[model samples]
Structure formats: C-alpha cells, structure tokens
Target: MSRAAFYDQIETTLDQMRETGLWKPERLITSPQGARVQVDGAGEVLNFCANNYLGLADHPALVAAGTEAMGEYGYGMASVRFICGTLDAHRTLERAIADFLHTEDSITFAACFDANGAVFEPLLGADDAIVSDSLNHASIIDGVRLCKARRYRYETRNLADLDRQVAAARKERPGQVLIVTDGVFSMDGFVADLGPICEVADRYDALVMVDDCHATGFIGPGGRGTPALHGVEDRVDIVTSTLGKALGGGMGGFVAARQPLIDLLRQRARPYLFSNALAPALVGGAIEGLRLIAEGDDLRNRLEANAARFRSAMTDAGFTLTGEGHPIIPVMLGDADLAGRFAVRLLAEGVYATAFSFPVVPNGTARIRTQMNADHTDADLDVAVAAFTKVGQELGVVS
Candidate 1:
C-alpha cells in the first residue's frame, strides 16, 4: 500500500482498539510515587498500580543518595560504557547487584527489556536452542526472535511440558540448550517453580535463566529473588532483573550470571555497548537501595502483611483473584471493557488502580493488577478493599 493508505490503516486499527475498549490511557501523577499520590485530575488517591514494592520510590534515603551522587559525579555519562561511560558508580552498582544476587558478575543495561533483548543473540547461535515458558515476557519473546537459535516453548510453569520441550530440543542435538522463564509472572503474580525447573534443567543438561524483574529485591529471603526463595540460587545459571522495581524504583536493568557470561555480554550486548551509561544518581540510589533491601526484613514483613490483608479481604468479598504468596494481586475481570470501567469507578472511590487488557495480557484474562508496598498501612488496605467491594457490587461482579 502507498504511504497515505498505510497511515489510514493504522488510524483505523487505533479506532477499532478504542471502540473495543482495548485502549489504555495514562494517568498523570502530580506527586512522587508512594502509597498515596496526587493525581493531576483526580487529586490524592491510594495508589495500587505501581511496581514500587518496597515503597522506596520517594524514600528520603534514596533521594539523598541520588542527589549526593549527582553532585559528586555530575549528571549524565554522555557516552557508552566502552567509550568512557563506565563510571565508578556503575561498577559499584554492578558489584552490589552481583553480591546481592550471589552471582559471580553482572552487567547493566538501560532496562530489563534491553537486557533480555541483548542476552540471547550473544550467547546462543544457530546450533543452539532455547526452550521458553509460553507466558514469558514479551522481551524474552522478542529476544528469542532476534537469535538464530532454534526455539521451543512449553505451557506456562508446567514442568511436564518443559520436560517434553527440552527432550524435543535435545533431540535436535543442539550445541547448547537454555531454559528461560520469568521468576514472577507479573500479570498473574505467580512465582515460577524454580526448584523443579532446576531439576528439569539438570536432567536435560540445559542452562537455566530467569528474568526476575518483579521479584529481585523482595520475593525471596533477604530479597534475593525466586532462586533463593526456592533454595536453587546456585543452580540457576543466569538472572536478569530491573532496578526499576522495589530497588528504589528508579530505572535500570542488569544480567547477573557466571563470570564468563557477564564478560561476553559486556563485550557484545548491544544495549550496554550502545546506550549511555546509567545516570550517576540512579546508580548511587540503587546501591543504597540494595543496602536497604539487604537489611529490610521489617519492610518485607510489612509488605507481606499488606498483601495478605488485601488478598483475604478481596477474596472474602467475592472477587476472583489470581496469584498467592506474592505482592501482586490481579483482580480478574474477563471483559476488557468491564475491567476499564471498574478501574474508573475505583478512582472515584479514592483508590488509584489501572485496568489491564489484551496485548498486555491474554484477550479473556483482563484484570486490575494491584500491588502492595511496605508503606501501605492497615487503613490503606481497608480502603482499597472497600472500594473494590463497592465497585464489584455496583457492576454485578460480586453478590
């Protein structure tokens, strides 16, 4: 088609999305992210949609560290790592991450998306293969697509299916086989069975990689993530996670792995090679965040209590919720339009949550994914549950 026709077609698709209630709109947060935030049009509301699990986005210590680093190291790197972008702060943050995750070494990226995008192509070749969870993040899907390695997929978190897929991939006699999955599936809030996954990988002689973006700073004991949670930290081969969630809630991603894998990515990961180094402020804050997380049993306890409170109350009120023993609680509303409407009504009731629909999730699995933070109090949990209950009753979602 000609350029004009192509543009018109794109517009038509957008219109269809809006009409079908699949369009997602952004809310303006006038104040810093925390349990309570000021929305530009809606005023202050209890925020339940953020990934700020530890509630450190606006913490005083993180803010001070970031500010101090900016003053000490200047603002931006203005260059890539190999081209003089590597700052002492960068190395410090990477070391902190490796020490935190108990990995040999780690490499930083602009975001976990880039980390996922950069990982596959450098390590795997045409003679190799990747067996991925069916519901793995889109970045993993795209990363796998970019690699020339043969690909196989299994049902989400299904060990039997994974074993089958690995067996099939090995049948091809590939040089290397990697099994990858998300440590925590963000949409459903379900933690992967890492212990079992490690068992499967061992049986098949395949390496295991986990994208632990959602669990890195808060899921496991000492907040070491799912591998540690499952007592398989030494077994899992590679870990990719984000500093954007729970880790001061700034923005950066990294891959923690054995020394050789990290060394290879440092030399060849395009995102790290091409993107400007992380700002000094983010690095400094992340180091402090890691420190806080290392000694944050209190915060983790509070977070668990908040999640348990919300889940119990919502379930008792007759809302169908997904996931367990994790902070993410997705209130399932199968209809995309109904989910959107429910979120709007929630805002009116002084709760700030967003509806998730197709493309972000499967077509019939739309939900309002609520997250709990350590900063939230019992009163905040009560208010959120009340809002959800009222909205559910009004919309005939609950009795």
Candidate 2:
C-alpha cells in the first residue's frame, strides 16, 4: 500500500472510533495530582480516576526527598544502570522495595510495563511453559508473547481452571512452568485469589509471578501488596509493581524476587539493560514513599472507609457496583456509549471519572472505574456520590 493509503486507513479507523463513542479524549490537569485538581477546561474537579491510592502523590515528605536527591545526584541518570547510571540512591530504593515486599532483592525499571516485559524472556526458554490467567494485564500478555515459552491460559481467578491448565502444562514435561496473574484486575477492580493460585503453583512445582501494579502501596497489610494480603508472600516467586501508582504517584517500576533471580535479570533482562535508569529524584521519592507506606495504617484505614462509604452510598442510590473491600470501585453502566456519556456528565457535575469500554473491559461490561484515596474526605465522597446519582438519573442508569 502507498503511504497515503496507510494514512487514510488510520484516519478511517479513527473516524469509526469517534462514531462508535470509543474515542477517549485526554483531559488536561493544571495542578499536581490529588483528590481535587485544577483542570484546564473543566476547572477544579474532584478526581476519582487517579491511581494515587495513598494520597502521597503530592505529599510534602516525598517532595522534600525528591528535591534533596535532585540536589545531590542531579536530575537524570543519562545512561543504563550497568553503564554509568547506577546511583547509590538507586541501590537504596531497590533495597527499600525488596524490604517492603519481603523479597531477597529487587531491580528497578523505567516502568512496570518494562519490568513485566523484562521478566519472562530471560528466565523461560522455548522448552518452558507459562500458564497465565486469561484476565492478566496486557503487559503480561505482551511479555509472554516476547518469550518463546509454551503458553497455557486459565479462566480468570479460577483455581480449578488453573489446576487443569498446570496439569496440562506438566504433560509437556517442560523445563519450567510459570503461573502469572495480576494482583488486581484494573477495569473490574477484582482482586485475584492469590492464596489459591499459590497452592496450585506448589502442587505443580511451578513458579508464580504477580503483577501488583494496582495493589502495591495500598492493598495489603502495611500496603505490602497482594502477597501479604493473601499471606502468600513467601509462596509467590516473583512480583512486578509500579511506582507510578500509590508509591509517590511518580514513575518507575521494579521486580522483587529471590537474590539469584534478580541477579540474572540484571544481566539479561532486555528492558532493564536497554532503558535509562530511573531518575534519582524518583528513586529518592520512592524511598520516602516506602517509609510512609510502612507507617501508614491510618492512611489505609481512611482509604478503606472512603471506598466503603462511596460504594455503599452508590449501591443504595440504585447503582450497580463491582469489587469489595478495596478502593477501586467500578460503577457498572453496561453500554459503552452510556459509560462515556456518564463520565462526561460526571465531569460537568464536578467529578472527574473515566469510562472503561471495549478493549479496556468487555463490550457489554463498560463502567466508570472510581478509585478512592486517602486524600479524599467524607465530604468529597458525598459530593462524588451526589454527582454520580444525578448523572445516573439523567442517563436513566438509576431511578
């Protein structure tokens, strides 16, 4: 095809997306990430779509630490870690992450997507097998595709299906069998059944990897993540998580595992070896973020209360909601166009929430995924509930 033909084809796809209400528009935020933010066109609105679960995105301590680190180490690493990029603060952040996750060691990456991409290829060969949850994140799916490992898939969060898949995998007598899942599925807010997943792994002598990008820094005891929440910290073999969410709401990711596994990743993980080292400022902020998370029981409690309050109020107001006992609560709208319209109405009502449609969630299971954070107060919850109820009624999603 000619270049102009290719461009026309892309334009056709874009037009189709707009006609079908699948075109997601990006909003401009004019302030730091928090429960309330100044948006360019919408003015200041209550933000319920952020991953800043612990409300530490703009915390004073993290800012101070980042500033101090910038003064000491300058801004960027300018090189990969094995070259001239490894800073002492980088080592400190890695150790802090390993300690937080209760792992032997950890290695950093530019993003959790990179961390997940770096994981499978270096460890699993063509003779090995990877049994992944059907609902695992796209990062995991892409990572699996990058590796030459034999692939098996189980139904989402179904231990019985996992057992069957693992048994099938063992029939191949592969060199290794690795089971992978997301600690929390983002669109539906469903937490994975990790305890049972660990059991299946043990039964088959398979290694287990969890992408805890959504759960780290807020889901488990002391915000250690799904493994600690399920009491499977020692059972799970590998954990990949992000700093862009609850951990200071900055950018970086890491893999926490056994010392030898980390050592091997350092040498062979393509993303880590090829990507720039995480900035010293982010590392210092993450180090402080870990410290705050460790002593953040009160923050966790408030976050739970806010989520519960919002979930209960919304349900009582005649709205369907998904997930339980976690900050992520999806207000189910079913139709993609309706979901998009609901979000637009919510924004106009002073609530900032986004719609999850096909490609993010199943076609008929579209929703506005609302997330609660420690920074949101009862008043904020009340305002959000009121906004949702108003929009819900206007859209006939509720009585």
Candidate 3:
C-alpha cells in the first residue's frame, strides 16, 4: 500500500477526475466482438467504439486460417525473434505487408505500439533531428522522445506552420531532418496531404515516414494508404500500421519500408530485440487478410459506402462532422460532461460509442467518436443515426 510516497495523490487525482466527469469504468462484454455486441447487464448494442473498420475479425476464412496455424505452430512463440520465434509464418506476414504497401521489405512487431517504439532511436541519433506533426499519435511522440535526436513539431497539416517549422530547423540546427505524420489523423478524420508534405520534405532533403494506422485499408486505390491516395506512394519511405485495425482484429503490427531501413530496424530496434514475437496463428491470419486485399477488397468498398452514407445523413440532420470521406466520424458536443452523457444515452438506445475529452482530445472540444465497419448494413446505420439524432437534440447538440 505504501509502495511510493505519492500514492495518496493517485487516489486524490482519481477523485478529482470523477468530479470532473473524466473518470471511466469499462463495461463487461457478454458476446463476441462484432457489428453488434451484448453487454453483461444490457441488451444487444451496436458497436461503434471499435477500430474494426473492415469487419474481418469474425470472417470464416480468417478464422479457418488462424485455427489451422494454431494446429501447425502451437500457441506461443515463448521467445523473441532473435531466438527460435522467427517462424516462416512471421516472415511471410512481413513479406505480405511489404507487397500490400508496395514497399521493398517489412518487419513485424507485437503491436504497432512497439513498432514505433523500436523505429526512431535505432534510425536516428542526437546529432540528427525529427520533425513531427503536432497531433501525431502518442506512439510516435514516445518513439521520438526515446531517441536522443533533437525534436521539432509542425502544426498538424498546416502548410504555413510546416514551412515555419522547416525554416526554423534549417536556420537553427542543420542536420539530417526527418518528417513524421499520421496518414490519417485518428481524432479528426483528416488525412495528411502527403503530396505537399513530400514536396516540402524533398525541398529540405529530409526523410519521410507516415503512420498509416487509420488509412491503410480504405484511403487509396485498392486501399494502399494515404500516400497512394495523394499520388506519392513512392515518396513515403517508411510506414507503420496495425493488423488489429483493418487487416485482422487480433494483435500485431508492422513496419514497411525499403530494404536498408528494414535491415537497420531488424539489427537494432530495442523492442524487436527484447519482445516475444507475434503469435503464429495471428501472423498466418494476417497473411490471409493481406491476400484478400490484393485479390479484391470488397470489404474496403463497403466501408467507403458506409462512411459516405453516415456522414451525409448526419450532416443533413444538423450534426457537425469533422473532415469528409473517412470512416472515423466525430460528433462534436463541446462539453466533456455532455459528451459522456450523450454516450450513455446512445448506449441505452442500443448504440455503442465512446466519448473523447481532455488529454485524449482538447478540453472544450469533447466529442463522441464513431467508427464505421464494412459489415454495418444500411439498416444498421439508419438505426444508429436515428439514435444519434435523438440524443443530440435532447442534449442540445443539434436542432
């Protein structure tokens, strides 16, 4: 109980969080993860809180592949890739990701969290510099911090701020500069304009990397990613994304890039050196998921259609959404308390969604973030949208 002198402050802060409407308690799930889920004490609930954009988690073919791999390779690796954990399936998944991303080579990690953790430091040093977007995912921020490189942050996708930042870097600390950004900003559903960013990077002779966690499966032709959508797939040198998002809803991540960068990460990334490799069954399932994308992404097409329908209806209903054309839709409520209340009311109406507030998002810009999946039918979206409309008006968020 007395592990640290600051223990009482932890309880004190938690109490404060409850008072401020920031304290969250997770609910128990009584059914499988899918388009609709059952809560322990509640009835059937439409899932809008998950990152399962492709709805591939419960596909029969993926399940079959996973089960077969389990039979072929057992349960766990029990060791890191440096040891006996580097199975043929793991290497195959890596290669599969490279082919999907149109990159030269790739590497696998336990999660995209670790892929970013292992990426920066091994590739850059104190003498080098990292120029990152202000609103990049926390993983990339932590990765840059773990490295000794000088850090520079540009305003999120603002060309003026980007130029200002680049100018500052060139004027003050001239070295090998690297630019980092998310292919799609998860919170706002805004895609990075990689064409212009690449032009800027080329001007500065800086390396370019994108974290394509949110855009990998529905952003470009055949869902290549934001870079491909922006017509600069060849300009992005490295990309990191999760299999758990659009590919498979299990747990795995990957880094795809040229052969030299891949070789360097394999040789020196700390997380790669220390962590247990991905489970063989999951790796095999991810390989199958990639194969499906290349063969024909009916899932991706359905997801786009769903996003368009929901966004159009929500906007017509007087609900404001962030940027257009992405499955991640943010319903702005402005007050953290109200957003939380709105989420509860929607849940009671059998629609499951989560509210974002301070630290996760800006304090006054609180919102209920809804993610669409390929499996959500027209009727399902209409039902969810009706729930939102009702709750929104009752809460004064619309009309």
Candidate 4:
C-alpha cells in the first residue's frame, strides 16, 4: 500500500478509538511521583493513581543512591549484559533480590515487562503446558503467546477451575506443567490464594510461578511478597517482580528462581541477551530500596495503616470496594461512563485517581483503582475521602 494510504488507515483507527471512548490521553505531571504531584493545568493534586505503595519513588535515600551510582558506574552501559554491560552493581542488586525473595539466584531485566516477555520461551517448550489465570497481567499473556508451550487458562482465582485446567492439560501428557498466576491482581487488588494454589500445583506435580510486580514491596512480612504472605515462599518455583513499583519506582525487573533457571535465562532469554542492560542508577537505587524493605517494618506498617484507613472510610461512606487487605483499593462503580466521570470529579476535587473500564477490566466492573502509600499523610487521606464522598453523593453512588 502507498504511504498516504497507510497513514489514512492508521488515522481512521485512531479516530475510531476516540469515538468509542477507548483512547487514553496522558495526563502531564510536572512533579516527581509521590502522594501529591503537580499535574499540568490541574495544579497540585493528591495522587492515588500511582503504584508507589511504599512511597519510595521520591525517597531521599534512593535519590542519593542513584546519584552516587551515576558517579561511580557512569551513565548508560551501551550494551547487553553478555557484551560488556554487566556491572558489579547489577550483580549486587541481583544478589540482593535473590536473598530478599529467598531464591537461589536472580537475573535482572530492563523492566518487569521484559522479564515476563523473555521468561516462558526460554523455559517451556511445545511439549510443555502452562496453566495460567485468566486475569494474569497482559505481559504474561503476551509472553505465553510468544512461547511454544500448550496454554491452559482458568478463571481468575478459581482453584476448582485451575484444577480442572491442570487435569485437562495433563491429558496431553506434557513434559512439564506450570501453574502461573499474578501474586496480586492489579485491577481488583485481590491477593491470590497462593497456599491453595500451591496445594493444587503439588497435586499435579506442577511448578508454580508468580508475577509479584504489585505485591513485591509491601504485601507480606518484610515485604517479601505474596508467597511470603501465604507462607508458601518455599513452594513457589519462580518469581518475577519490578523495581519500578514499590522498589524505588525506577526502571528494572528481575526473575528470582532456582540457580538452574537463572542460569538458563542468562544464557537464553532473548530480551536479556539482546536488550540493553539496566542503567546504573536503577540498579543502585533498587539495591537501596531492597535494603530498606529488608531492614525495617515502619514503612510497611504506615502503608497498611493508610490502606486500612482509606478502605474503611470509603466503605463507611457506602462505596463498594473490591479486594482484601492490599494497598490497591478499587471503588467499584459498575458503569463505565460513571467510573470515568467519577475519576474526573475526583481530579476536580484535588484528588488524582484513574478509572479502569472494559478491556483493562471486565465490562460492568468499572472502578477507580486508588492506591495507598506510606507517604500519604492522614490529612491527605482525609482530603481524598472528602473528595470521594462529595463525588459519590453528587453522582448518587452513595446515600
């Protein structure tokens, strides 16, 4: 096709997206990620949309660590790890992560997205089967698509469905059966029932893998993640998480698993072998973030308290929420347009949150996915509660 024709086709698709209310527009933020930020034209707003659960995104310690690493390791690596890009800092951070997760070893990736993308293809083959939760992250879904493994998907957090899927996959006589799930379902903030899942995996002699991107920093004791929360840290075989969320809010991801798995990924993972190495700043900052998480419970306590307070207030105010005791609190609105208007009203009231509708979430389950952080003060939370209440009352969502 001609270039003009190609351009016209793309423009028509974009127009269709806009008309369908599916196009997502970026909201420009002028300040660093934290409890409150300066949104362009919106001025300062309490940010409840970010994944900064532990609030270390703009922590002074992480800033110092990054700056120090910049001076010590210089800037970019300019090459992949196999090609002279492996720094001592990278190894240090990987080791720190492995120790944190109680895994044999770990391998770093440019982002959790890359880690998830490169994982399955290197490990599972066409004869193998991967049984995954239907609501697993998009990255996991995409990664599974790229792999040659026979895929079996079960309903979200449905153990019975998982058992059925596993039994069905076993009928294929695959070499390996892997049960994969998100440690924390991002949209609804529901922590996966890892213990039961682990039991089910053991029944089928299948290895369990958890993508703990949303739960890595503060979901469990010492912030060791969902496995730790469920007391199945030793049962889970592989864990993939990101430094971009609770850990420094920088850009880096890692896969922590048995030494053999890590070794294989090092040798064969395409994204790791082909992509540029994570920059020194992120590695250094992540190391410090891990240290902070390992050494103390103060931040975790504060974060839990904030989440509890917010969840209680929203519930008491008659807003229906999904999920258990996780920082991600989804205020269920049922209707997509109402959810969008709710978020807009929230922003107008100086609270910044985002609405998740169809495609991102199931249709009719539209919600405002608000996240809590340690840095959010009681006053900030009160302001947010007031804003939610005002909007909920105005929209007749709450009596």
Candidate 5:
C-alpha cells in the first residue's frame, strides 16, 4: 500500500474514534507522582490518578537508594542478564523479592510485560491446557495468545465458570493445565476470588498463576499480595508483577516461583536472554521499595483507609463502584461521552482522575478510575468526593 493510503486509513479511524468519543489524548505530566501533582500547563491538581498506591513513588528512601546504586553499580546494564550484566545487586534484589513473596526463587525481567511474555511458550506446550480469567490484563492475554497450549477463557471472577473450565480441561487434556488470573482487575479494581479458584485448581490437579501487578505493595495484610490475602500464599505456582507501578514506580518486572521454575526461566525465557538487563538504579530502588513496603504498614494502612472512605462516600452518595477493598477504585460512568466529559470537568475543577471507556474496558462500562494513596489526606479526599458528586449530579449520573 502507498504511504498516502496508509495515512488515509489511520486518519479515517482517528475520525471514527473522535465521532464516538473514543480517541485518547495523552496528558503531559510536569511533576513527580504524589497527591498534589502539577500537570504540564495546569497548576497543582489533586491527583486521584496514578498507580502510586502506597504513595512511595517519590519517597526519600527510594530516591536515596536509586542515587546510591548509581555510584555503586553504575547506570545501565548494557548486556542481557546472561552476558556480563547480572550483578551482586541483581542477585540480592531477586532474593529479596522471593523472600517477600515467600517463594522459592525469583527472576527479573525488563518489565512485567516481558515477564508474562517469557512464561507462556516455554512452560506450556501444545499438549497442555490453559484456563484463564476473561478479565486478565492485556499482557496475560497476549502471552496466552503467543503460547501453543490449548487455551480457554472463563468469566471474570465467576468461580463456577472457572470450575467448569477446569472440569472440561481435565476431561479433555488429562494432565498439564494452568489457571491464570490477575490478582486484581485494574479497570474495575475487582479482586480475584483466589481461594475458590485455588480449590478448583487443586481439585482439577491444575497449577495456578496470577499477575499481581496491581495487588502487590497495596493489598493483603502487609502487602504480601493476593495469594496471601486468600490464604493461598504457597498454593500458587507462579506470581508475576511490575516494579513500574507500585514497587519502585520506576521500571522493572519479576516472576517468583519455585527454584526450578525460576531456574528454567533464567535459562530459556527469551526476554531474560535477549533484552538488556534492568538498570542498576531501578533494581536498587526496587530493593528499598520492597523493604519499605515490608515495614510500611503505616503507609499501606492509610491507603486502605482512604480507599474505604472513598468507596463508602461514593456508595452513600448513590454511586455504584465495582471493586473490593483495594485502592484501585473505579467510579462507574457507563457512557463514553459522559466519562470523557466527566474527566475533562474533573480536570477543570482540579481533580486528576481519568475516564476508562471502550477498549480499555468493555463498551458501556465507562468509569472514572480513581486511585488512592497514603499521602491523600481526608480533606483532599473530601474535595475529590464533593467534586465528583457535583459533576455526577450535574451530568445526571446521580440523584
């Protein structure tokens, strides 16, 4: 096709998206992540958006650690891990992550995106079976798509459907099967009912895997993660998560599991073998992030308290939010135009929450996904709630 033909097709799609209010305009962030953030041109805004769940994105401790790592280990590891890249700090960070999750061993990746992509093909063959939650993150879906395993997707959080998938898999595939799900659904903040899923996995002699990207450093008793929350800490076989979001808030990913699996991933996973190693600074910062989250009951507890307050206030104000007690709260708006308009209005009123509509979520399940942080005080939360109520009622989304 000619360059003009390709350009014309993209322009036509962009126009279509604009007509349906689905085009996403990127925002320019001017400040480091925190409760009060400065957007590119906007003044300081009350930021209810961002994945800084524990409010540790720009913490002094993390900053010191990263800065110190630069002096100790230098900046970037120019080579892949297997070739003159893995350092003592890399080994220590992997051990710290494994210890934190109470797993046998752990392996690092460029990002959790790479971690998920690394696992699917190497572990599961065409003869095996994979049963996945339909609401799994895009990374998980893509990983599964790349695998040769016979794949099956079940309803989101419907334990009964998971059981059905397992039963069908056992009847057909007879042996190797993996049950995959996200620890918490990012779009709706809904937690996976891992206990029941564990039961089904156990009954069907299937292995369990979870992408803990959203749940780690925020959920569970001491931020031990989703399996810990469900009393299945040791029941899960594989756990994958990103350091980009909650952990370091910089960039990196890891997969924790039994020593054998970690060893195998290190040996065979393409990303670990091909991609440039994580920056020394990020690895160092992540080590400290884990330490802080371990001793961070004060910060993590405050985040939960904030999420509870927001969920309760929104419910009392006649809004339906889909999620458990996790901090990733989605304020359901239902219409794409309404969500976009609501986000723009919230920005105008100094609140920084984004709208999730078609594609990022199911069509008609548009929402204002608000995240809570330990740094957000009750007064700031009140401001957010009142602004939401005002805009919601103005939009006639609430009575």
Candidate 6:
C-alpha cells in the first residue's frame, strides 16, 4: 500500500475513535506515583487512580534498595535469562518470591503480561482443556488463545456456572484440565470466589491458577494473596503476579508453582526463555518489597483502612459503587459521556482519576475507577469525597 493510503486509513480510524468518545488521552504526571501528583497543566491533585496499594511506590526503602542495586549490579542485563543475563539478584528475588508466596519454585519474567502470555502455551496442548472465568484478565484470554487447548468460560464469580463448564469440559476427556481466574478483578475490586472454585476444581480433578497481580502484597493476612484469603493456599496449583503494583511499584513479574512446573516453564516458556532478564534494580527493589510485606501488617492495615474510609464516604454520599470494600472502588455513572465528564470534573476539583466505559467495561456500566492507597490520608480522602459529591450532585447523579 502507498504511504498516503496508510496515512488516510490511520486518520480515519482516529476520527472514528474521537467521534465515538473512545479516544483516550494520556495525563502527564509531573510527580511520582502517590496519593497526590502534579499533572502537566494541573498543579497538584490527590491521586485516586494508582495501583500503589501499600504506599511503597515512592517509599524511601525502595529507593534505597534500587540505588544500592544499581551500584552493586550495574544497570541493564542486555540479554535474556537463558543467555548471560541472569544475575545473583535475579535468582535471589525469584527465591525470595517463592518463599514469600510459600511456593516450591518460581520464575521471573519481564512483566506479568509476558508471564500470562507464556504460561498456557508451555503447559497445555491440544489434548488439554482450559476453563476460565468470563472476567479473567485480558492477558489470560490471549494466553488461552495462543494455546491449543479446548477452552471453556464460566460466568464471573458463579460457582454453578463454573461447575457446569467444568463438567462439560470433562466430557471432552482432555489430557489435563485447568481453571483460571484473577484473584481480584482489577476493575470492580471483587475478590474471586476461590474457595468455591477450588472445591469445583477438586471435584473435577482440574488444576487451579490465579493471577494475583492486584491482590499480592496487600490482600489477606501477611499479604500472601487471594489463595490465602480464601484458605486455599495449598490448593492453588499455579500463581502469577507482578512487582509493578504493591511490590514497590516497579516493573517485573513472576510465576510461582511447584518445582516441576516452574522447571518446565523455564525450559519451554517463550517469554521467560526469550525476553530480556528483569532489570537488577527492579529485582532488588522487589526483594525489599517482599521483605517489607513479610515483616509487618501495618502497611496492609493502613491500606485497608483507607479503602474502608473511601468506600464508606462514597456510599454515604449517595453514589453507587460496584464490588465489595476493596481499594478499587468504581463509582458507577452509567453513561460513557457522563463518566468522561465526571473524571474531567474530578480533576478540576483537585482529584485525579480516570473513567471506564465500553470495550474496557460492559456497556451501561461506565464508572470512575478510584483506587485507595495507604499513603492517602483522611484529609486526602475527604478532599476526593467532596469533589465526587460536588460533581455528582452537579451532574444529578446524587441527591
């Protein structure tokens, strides 16, 4: 195709996005990820959209750890793990993660995206089957598509549907069966019904896998994640998570499972075998983050308190919120245009947040997704609540 045709096609698609109100614009942050940030034009605003659950994104300890690692291990690895990229810090972080999660072994990846992308292709084949939750993360969906396994999707958080799906999958008589879900759905903050799911999997002799990216380092006692939260730590067969969120808010991911499974992944997982090793600074910072999680529950308690405060205030302000009292609180607005305007109004009122609409979420369920963090003070929450209240009332979303 000619360059002019290519340009015209791209421009037409961009026009369609703008016309449909689906165009997403990036907000430039002049400050670090925290309870408050400075946007490019907006001087400063309370941030309620970050995934820094434990307030460690800008923590001094993580900074120190990253700085120390830079001095000790230098900068980039320049090669993948299978080559000469593996460092002592990489192995140490992998082992630390395994110990933290009480798993037999673990393998690091460049990101949780890669970890999820590579997991299914290596473990399951044409003769196997995968039973997934309807609302599982997109990465899992893509991973399942890449694999040759027969696929089945159960209704979100519905055990009866899961049972039906698993039973149906069993009729195929596949070599192996795996049930996958996110520990905590990112958009709605609904914790997966892992206990029931595990029971179903056990009855059907299916393996259970959880992507605990949103729950790790903040959910459950000792922050061991949703498997522990649901009393199925030993029952979950595979776990994948990221260091990009609560774990110091850096970048990297890992898959934790039994020794043999991790060993097989190391040999066959394309993301692990082909991607460049995780940076040393991230590995070191994450190791420190894990240490912090293992050391105390103060951060977790603070985070939970913040979430409770925000949820209660929002509910009291007469806004409908989806899911339970978790950090990810979506204040439902229903209309995509209204949700977009609500977010803009929020930013103007000194609260920074983003709205979700169709394609990202179901239609007629547009909402402003607010994430609470340990770093947010009572004053900060009050400020955000006031903003929401004012905007919600002005927009006639609340009485």
Off-target runs (Cα >4 Å) in candidate 4 are: none
Residues 159-278 of candidate 5 have per-residue lDDT tens digits of: 888899888988888559999999999898888989999999999889999999998887787888999999999899999999988785889889999998999889989889999999
The sequence of per-residue lDDT tens digits that candidate 6 reaches over residues 5-85 is 999999999999999989999999988888889999888999999999999999989989998998898898999888899
> Which prediction has more favorable lDDT, 2 or 4?
4
Model 2: residues >4 Å from true position, as ranges? none
Model 4 lDDT per residue over 185-223, tens place = 999989999999999999999999999999998988889
Report lDDT (Cα) of residue 38, candidate 4.
99
lDDT of each: 0.94, 0.92, 0.88, 0.94, 0.90, 0.92
Q: Per-residue CA lDDT of candidate 3, range 104-203, in tens?
A: 9999998899999889999888778888999999999999999988999988999778877776776666567788999999999888989999999888
TM per prediction: 0.98, 0.98, 0.97, 0.99, 0.97, 0.99
TM-score of 5: 0.97
Clash number for each model:
0, 0, 0, 0, 0, 0
lDDT (0-100) at residue 372 of candidate 4?
93
Model 2 per-residue lDDT at 344: 89
Which of candidates 2 and 5 reaches a greater TM-score?
A: 2
Error of 2 at 144 (Å): 0.6
Compared with the true structure, the alpha-carbon lDDT of candidate 3 equals: 0.88
Better of 3 and 4 by lDDT: 4
Model 4 local distance difference test score = 0.94
Question: Candidate 3, 221: how far from true, in Å?
Answer: 0.9
TM-score for model 2?
0.98
